[model samples]
Target: MKTSFVSNLAIQSAMRLTIQQTQAELLKRSQEQTTGIHYDLGLTLGATTSRSLNLQRELDRMSAMKSTNAVVTQRLSASQGALETMQKAAEKVRDTLVTYKGNDGVDAMKILKTEVNGALQIFTSAANTSFNGEFLFSGINTDVKPLAEYNSVPPSAAKAAFDTALTNYMSANSLTDMSQFTPAQMQDFISNTLEPMFTGPGWDANWSDASSQNMTSRISASEVIESSTNANTKSFRMFALASVISSELMDKNVNSQVRNTISNAAFGYVEQAIAGLNGERSSLGISESRVKKATTSLEAQQKLLNTHILDINGIDQIETATRVNTLKTQLDTSYALTSRLQQMSLLNYL
Candidate 1:
């Protein structure tokens, strides 16, 4: 019943299959040892494959978020620095005006005007600060400059409005002395003309390069934060109005009465601006802290995800190497045995 001999073709085929299987095992072991990761995830985590895959996807998404957050942190840091510099310039201007309020000396006034102009220029440059080619103070209009030049050859809309009001006041009263105008008239001009010029449609016409909608970025799964500032903010407008008043008062053609009115207004505006600037600083500081905190938390999350992923897919190098070595030895021994068997003739069995 068992007299059938094994054919040469069958023996060859079995040997080939065995060799192929050994080679495949060797390759897998080598790969696992080199990479410290299993080649076949399904084989490594058969029952938990779906869970592991979801975790991997989460890890990938978190990695992308971390990368984006780094850029956001840089921009926020830069913005904070620029705003600090801007606030300092405004403070200096305010202090200087307060210190020399009643001094009408040519030399003293000249020095004050020079300082005001310098501070204004510094503030203007800060307002136009950029990071990675995007304007920081432009709100959603990242590509547009947030402010026109402080002494633009063609006056800004706000400045033109002020000029027109001044001309009308002089023409209507037939008065050379702006002092002739009562306190009520001066108040009316400021309320109806200058203040309104920095808000609503006037704000859009004068300085805003930004939309009302701010730029926002997701800092976490459930959290988003504003990533932009704008020239139209009340704090920025207050500083701008103060600067314009100081610059105009420096004109020698303007009388002492006009200069006094402008100086008093400028002083009040500067004081108010300091308070507004403090609020702006407070808000920005809070946002910066949040960004830093989010970054730290995200980094911790990513580290945990990496550890979890490794737990699921990582192979032990020592064990994998040992398995490879055993396979190689087995394959070599099989080849040697096969060769010996081939050499043995049927006559040897007699």
Candidate 2:
């Protein structure tokens, strides 16, 4: 038999190393037990770690899209509310015009002008509405205000342009007095000059800073939708025309025939505005529905991906807990043995 001498230092060093390793394993198993997931994914999953990483990345992407969809839904809802407000304002103006069409009374004209001005204010305010620090009616120009106030101090460019157009039309036709403002002359001016102003580049130059292109948002990975409308729409232009005609020309010192013509034109424009607004609202409703469906799809995909990720990286919590408890017992025994070894000195015998 060969007898080998082993020093206490070597035995203590070995025990210390064993304790360190057991402590590390215990910590890992404890964490796995607590989290119900593998503590070290790369180590446990090995070559398949890339699969877990990809699934987690996709899950994160879906979460981001869901957050964006929440914001889109909010913006669309706010825009719909604003449109409804504008529609109501336009409807009020239309109803008032219809109610008191032929009445050239001072009070009726005053009421008509007041209502028209009110509607213009409401429409302008609604068109300039902002959500999440972006203008709802600015189209692609989200940071810019869409519509200038027509009744602003010193008058807006739109108001100034209207005055200039009226002045030029009066000057060109050599109309001396308000009585000379015939229905034929008014119709010609409205058709040839005013209509073109609202429909052409003049509107962009003077009235609206909004873009013709609307704001679009991605509701899903493959789906996109226009999330905003602009004040440059024909509906808004018609509303403005109806308001301008009713406010500027309604209370003028003209005959009933000219007044009726102005009333009829304004009413027609208001009707068009209402219908166009309804169409806009309907379009937005469709987008809202699509967003909802996309959200549902994303949730289902997220759930499926989570299941896949769990299958790849999930730990058996019951087994992990048992291992953790076993490690704790081993670590305690190691600690006790280490303490005993520390106390093992030849001085006691001496």
Candidate 3:
């Protein structure tokens, strides 16, 4: 009987230790959830959170790209509006020269010349347009103004330089009709315009990537009109019409025709700029669409990953509570059994 009691006592002690160890493990897991990886709980919550952070960062980058695109779009929209106004003026100039072909009037010619000079200034301003401190039409030369100013030079000198430049542009293309345009056509225009100034050459690297912010920025400064898209906000056909009109006025001894012709040519450059702007708009649209799609898809993926991470690491409080209560009951039973064994000595058992 004494041997049996000793043996039972040994078993009771071992069983209590086992119960305590099990409770300790439960407590450790709980702590891990609360304290992250460094805590005694040793839960996967910290790892899950880390993954979530990485996804969030990528989302943030995509969001920033979208914001950048929005700004560029707005700027382009404003530029297009300006181009439209300039085109109307160019058409009017053409009509005037056509009107003055036989009508001899000094006062009328003076008025037309004034309007033409005003148009010239407007178009030059457009070419020199800037956004946030960088020139929009200067290609890669953001700081350098694309249109030259000749306030210090005499009117004839200015006209001579301007006409020479235009003639150079026309001759450089050897392109009689501004109908079809490709990447090569555009590059040829740029080369023709910049080549005279630089013996070396135009920088072909200005638009190396589709995502080039600078490329989009230089949209409205083409040297000549290829199509209506390239047509000055006014239109190349319209500019040619104006030139014909100006020549008619010159034939009729209208003094304003010469100045008006020069002004019309400059503004015509503004008209062709529309094509470049449209190209940029198209590019921006594609970029924006891609960014939005990518962002949305990435967000969805991130959300799913987050859900997975939660499942891996998150605890069900209700379930845990139930478990804890059950463990407590078992522990209490063990303690009670231990007490019974300790108290029930051989003498007491009798």
Q: Report lDDT per candidate.
A: 0.78, 0.92, 0.46
Q: What are the clash counts of all predictions, listed in order?
A: 0, 0, 10
Task: Write down the lDDT that model 1 would get.
Answer: 0.78
How do all models score by TM-score? 0.84, 0.95, 0.44
Candidate 3's TM-score reads 0.44
Instruction: Give the lDDT of residue 242 in candidate 3.
Output: 35
How good is model 2 by TM-score? 0.95
Model 2 lDDT tens row, 154-193 = 8889899999999988999998777899999988887788
Q: What is the lDDT of residue 171 in candidate 2?
A: 90
What's the candidate order when arranged by decreasing lDDT?
2, 1, 3
Please provide, for model 1 over 1-350, each residue's C-alpha lDDT reduced to its tens digit, 9 standing for 90 to 100. Answer: 56877765567667767878998999988888888888898977898888888988998887788788888878888888888888998898898888777667778788888888898889989989999999888888899988876576777666676677678866876757654665555656665677777765777776766666677888877778887667778878888878777776544444466556667887788777778777776776777788778878988998998898888889888888889999999789768766765666768788
Single out the weakest 10-residue window by summed lDDT for candidate 2: 27-36
Model 1 stretches astray by more than 4 angstroms: 1-20, 176-187, 250-258, 330-350
Residue-by-residue lDDT tens digits, candidate 3, 165-220:
54565566674432323335433433354333222211112211111124432112
Model 1 CA lDDT for position 22: 92
- Reference-based TM-score, model 1: 0.84
Residue 168 in candidate 2, Cα distance off native in Å: 1.3
